[model samples]
Target chain A: MNHTIDDQVLAIGIPTDLLSTTVESLRAEILPLFDDTALKYSQVGKVHLNLCAVNMIDSAGVNFLVGIIRACQTRKLGITVTVKSRFVHRTLLFLRIDRHVELVVAS
Target chain B: MRVVETHTSPGNILGVDDDGVARLVLDQYLSRSGFRPELATSVMHAQQIIEMRPPGYFDCVITDYQMPEKSGLDLLIWLRSKDPCLASIVIAGAGEKDLVAAALRNGANNYLDKPYRREDLEQAVNKAVETTRHRRELARNEADAAAVGHLQRHLLGGRNLAIPGKVHFSHHPKRTAGGDFLNVHPCPDGALLVLAADVSGHDLKAAFVSAYFQGIVRGMLEKSTPIDEVLSFFNHCLWSDWGDRSAVTLEMPTSLSLCAAVLPPGRGQATLFSAGFPDAQVVLPSGEIRPCGVGGGHPMGWFAEALPERKTVDVPESGWLVLWTDGLEDHARQLAVSPWGLAYTLLRRDESTARRASIGDAIDDILVVAVALGSASFDEGFPILADQYAGDRWREIDAIQNEWRNTLTLAIPALSEERLCEILICLREGMLNALKHGCKGRPECTASLRFQYQSKARNLRAWIDDPGPGHGFDWASHAYVAQRDLLPSHRGLSMMHHFASRIENHRHGASLTLDFHLPEPP
Candidate 1:
């Protein structure tokens, strides 16, 4: 997964499995560089997750996404997720996660 | 210094004289007496002031006799013709006793002599002030009552229709506050409801309760309450609110006659419940009139526990339904109704204004509503309200479908309940396709539906209109899907076609029409 920042948007490309090891690297490595609470400047409260390469998320991955959404909601942060795969969109719709998360799909 | 508070504003006084000294002296004295006094040098100028002044502004007038052009008696005569109750004090020079007599004849309230004492002028001004204050108070009270009458007219002003339908009605009250009322609401079952009521007596109290009662009925109808329960609830609400039915000699105690009905549109049937009202009559297309129902029940609020019998009447194709209070019948005789009578009343109505109008200014409270059952032009049909909403408006779509079904059932009850449900499911399928395929799976894009039911023709038809490029669906290929074991995702357009007597697809899958045949009423 590639991490990039342009202007105020933090586009974080996600992994396919979204396993513990992948999430661990994000928290320890990628998150610290972006979550700059010590400095005066920081990424705006907006984060966009590109899930074009990711598919077939399990319950664990779903739970992880929900946690991030809840945290963003509390900090008055907005999160946008783009899913390219119809299967992933169907799964999210089945779980009724679309009620809480803003899920964008290619028409 | 004492801060004395006057109970009311100081009275306005118009002082008139050709003599400058007399005018100045009169003005000073009146001013010291706490009056806003204006001076006019001649009778004509004073007359102009009274005519041009805001109505009821001047409280009193003081005039010196023997003015240049006109006398005090002339001004007094003019003021008396306008308002005899206006207070006036006439001033006369020595030996002008003859002129003072003429002033008194012209209705002057008091008189003061030229070179009169300070006490004499003071007493005359005081007495005149007392009478003018009394008159102003009475006039103010009259104005306040007129304002309340205006408010009642405003509250009853919601008689306009959002869209014109086959039904037409007219309501005429003898006073600004009369007890007649009418209401029409669409039911969830595709039926149209009509409510007409009259408070037992005329005037403000009756009119007020009529408006209040109509409001409650509307709230219940919006929740899709049944016609029977709606009437029962109305009766209970009235009885509970006003149970004091003791005799008041010649006065009829506060009670009301109400008739409520659900007419399944295009179904040729009307289910009605009435309280202390006469049987409504139907006016055939050929102008023949017949009674729709036979019985009249207790007046609403006559008893706490009363269930008026529900009567269902089937109207002839294109016939008109007439619901009225006795006032209309009375006006049908010799009573002149207001201007609305010429256009809407049955005897005077034509195709132009299909409603009812009264004849002459009626003393008795009058209200009438005549609904057209058949329109002359059936090809275009009466247009039902067409609305577009987001794809997720399934609840609204279901509501619309249910209303249409109910209308069919009410109009022709012999159709099996199962059959109605089947038709509704088919209709819903077309709508879902428009919302899903035509709108690109977006909840915000609009999908449209139109329903047409012609009870006389015994048919229910609907069209689902969408704004997307055609799905390019082929009806021939999907014709066998209902018979074959199908996947959950595959639409059973075949079942929809089977339920409908005839189905048509058009505009490259952008619009579809389903026609269902209704059974005879049991």
Candidate 2:
């Protein structure tokens, strides 16, 4: 599981490429970042997840991003996932991750 | 003629020779030898004779090494393969040492030379007859052992014992037959009696001891015997005997390791007696595991003075009492850790990513029993019990949703909508598996559900089980991140990981129990 997290707004960008093999590593890489910076979430009341560069995704990707959001809420922080791909949007809806995370469709 | 009374039935001998004269001579010789004889003119005739007779009709067979159509070596190979213990003698021509060797290699128990004297022929027959008698005795013993296993399995058929709180047990035998016995039943005063025993060996002797122990314990519990008295009865039964029938088993020096406890009905105090087995652990309601006792008592049956004494321990009202066999400690060693640590790791499930630890090549029978004491005990709420429901198709899922709502409304309406949704998702995924795998998507089969809420601790536990026989898969290999390479339909477990605190499956996936820690109310 391999992924690069580019944190801006000190934002943690989840892995863009999610091979099932790489998904776990991607999770491993990003979860600690969230854990360390969790205090920032209480200050803002919401955490933003960037899903723009994720060109292709599967059920695992949908659930992984969903889980990251869940992880955020598990820390008592609200999560807002910003996505531009209608594909990503629909995947979120189908997997029901949309119900848990606030989906901010980027223009 | 001296008949061996050891064999009540007449010994049936199969004699094979291509020459009619030799056959008649052998027939007359066997007749006077006090044995019944069946003669075949050739190896081929002997083969037909042996195959046509009722199984075990011929206790011994004698064949001429040199024959037309088929040789004695060929017949010996066939006969020995069908009954490896069949006593057989091959007759070789004079000075035919090589033929005699071949006959022995082909499974002849004895060999006689051609032109053999009556005494020599009788000597070979005597050895063959004795060997046949021994083989039959061994066969009968094996049959008797199988009967004991059958009766034990029949007694333990599809039985599930439900203790006050959440007590689930899963047993995997190293062999189809094993000596492991585990049971938990409430005493007349609401105190519980938990007996987990493992005898010395994996054979019927071991099973008999365990069955004997179960019977004694049952009788004493019926009479409302004290724990010390129960232990005394157990010890006495293992040491001395009550029913003279059990007296027979005590005649043999046998032993077993066990953890026997009488859990107080309301208070968290539990009296435990551990003998030569793993120390029982007390799991804090907070999920922290600590060893119950520093040391253990002696295993039953080695020394008369190795009497067991009572050691009392405190159990958390919301916590658990875990008892396991030595096999689990052995399993821990395979994982390169201490037994208690492995037990903790299993309970905490710290490595959600790795596969569940298994014994691998060093596998042994394992039993782990834990009792969380309380009557429908949780921090703040009782679990809404849902019995078996037909779960064959998707439309039926509506009934599950409705039931969940009813159970939730009746049980825990104060739960946040977000937490309720998470709980519902977990239920859906679990039942989906029960439907697809357990029920085979068949409309008639049913799956059951139970939901326990601990609002004080902000936790929810749901148990889902199905009636179908269980199956195994790679539970640890589930994908966490999504990708094209991800196996299709790799979503349920990942969903569970996201939504629940711990997802533990039992009975090879026929039952799934998940724990969820709810967030502080929004």
Candidate 3:
């Protein structure tokens, strides 16, 4: 469950299993970035979540994405989610999350 | 010529020796010691003599340790196979301890050393004879019990009464006999009285009580006695009669856990009374299973006022009424499988490879009865996954969800990834709601999830229940507002509504069912 966060563009890497067990740690890791005004407002006009390595996602993971989307909306920033799993892509589409964020299903 | 007494001997002994003088001495000594002795020149001769008599005719066999061709150890081994109840004593020379040990290990009860005193001979023969007698008595008792068990199974097998609907019942006893019993009595008004009970033990006494209880029910019901009155009488019989330790010789009082159902001829109200038994399930025509309303009460004999808790269930025109003994539920929980799934597995002709392993290791006497009401057809909903979660152990949710994922993929291979995702999402959301809101994160509180697949309807349904007094909330209104306002808070319910083909809530929202229609199997 390795993840990486790019400070320059505010791009966060999601682990392979985006479940309740992993979401909490991911949330903790990203909480400080939200506190830094320079990272949230100045350096990044948009937040990119690279979920290309994700194999599965549960409701908690979906709720995590929703939290990120809500945060981006409050800060007047756009967000995009990139995933390689068709299941995850379909889940996002099915839940109608694509209406708010640009979802890219990487081949 | 010595006058040998034929009667009043303690035991009949078979004495074997290759030496002629030794055989004569053994015969004389045994006769003088108040025992009947038959002399055999060799091991083969001893076998021939013993084979002519009944199994327990000769109480003990005294054989010389060393013999031509076949030794006494060989005779001891053969005697074990021929008559395990018969005991053997080996006569060995001094310093032949190894041979004596081999004879003892091979079924010789005791060994007599060469040049032994009359007391030593008598002591060895007496102990061996007593051992043989005890073993023979035990064998006789076991044979009798087995015969009775055979009769019980035969009688119970033919006890499936004629009812309006198609009755499918299965009983698997843990041993030759067990406590689990079922009887169906057809009433005068075309109603069927079905009783499934599990007596306390798995022995002959339990089987006897089970038969007696069924007979009482049959007699009382035939006399036009009210169901409640009949139950009351039976409870009193247990509490004051069988279960009373003061008069009964039983070490512990007998308690009977049972569930009785009165299913009408057609679609009507069905009466269910459960006394410390698992809840019966009603499988609707749509394949939705609803457990009996009455949970359970104290088992009969537990208290003087241990009345059966009664509940009325609306029977569908064409559905299934399922009843089972608690053994099925206990085993299902021990295996972490769905009780419904286990029942269906035991009922169906074909078994899944995954489930067959669990069925082979059943630890209880299982009985399941499923009656189709008012029709010949009932949708078979195969349960694939079932689990319970403590409200405080939410951290294990991911691992458990993955297990469900594996089971669903294996059970319904045609289930597309998209539909599986929908199921897992709804399951997590529903469980989270149950744990966080319903259970209020109490460690003692718990929630359960059951997933059933209806192959005929191509539908997968999830049933989730939490032990909580659920609050009133219009989920539809919340979903509508959440979707319209793009709110993140209550969108999980909206997602559930969107993904599931239908949603049903029961027990004041404590129980939730979500159904997703699957594509045609490829």
Query: Best-fitting candidate, measured by lDDT?
Result: 3
TM-score of model 3's chain A: 0.86
Candidate 3's TM-score: 0.66
- Per-residue lDDT of B1-522 in model 3, one digit per residue for the tens? 334334354999999999998988899889999998999998889989988987678989999989999999889889889999999888999999998888878888888889878888988888888888888777876876787678767766677734433777767666667788887888889888888889988777887888788789888988988788988998899888866456646366788988889977765789988888877878776555677776576688888888989888888886778888877787766655456666665665354633552544667778888887766342556455656788886767776676676657655656787678778877877888888877888889988888877778888888889988876777778765655556656556766777789998888878988888998856
Candidate 2 stretches greater than 4 Å from native: A1-107, B1-5, B8-10, B42-54, B70-74, B93-105, B113-115, B153-180, B188-192, B199-206, B239-256, B263-269, B284-287, B300-307, B316-320, B327-522
The per-residue C-alpha lDDT of model 3 at residue B30 equals: 92
CA deviation > 4 Å runs, candidate 3: A1-107, B1-9, B93-105, B113-115, B161-165, B222-225, B239-252, B302-307, B349-364, B375-379, B382-391, B398-448, B455-522
User: What value does DockQ give for candidate 2?
Assistant: 0.07
Instruction: Estimate candidate 3's alpha-carbon lDDT, on a 0 to 1 scale.
Output: 0.78
Model 1: per-residue lDDT, tens digit, B113-229?
878876787788778878876776766555554564565445444443543665566556676567878777777777888888888777767867886777777887788777678
Q: Would you list the rank order by DockQ, best first?
A: 3, 2, 1
- CA shift of B249, model 3, Å: 12
User: How well does each candidate superpose onto the true structure, as a TM-score?
Assistant: 0.45, 0.48, 0.66
Candidate 2, residue A10: how far the Cα is off, in Å? 47
Model 2 agreement with the true structure over B388-440: per-residue lDDT tens digits: 66756644664456556544533444566556655665677677778777888
TM-scores of chain B, in order: 0.53, 0.56, 0.74
The sequence of per-residue lDDT tens digits that candidate 3 reaches over residues A24-51 is 8888877776665756454677788899
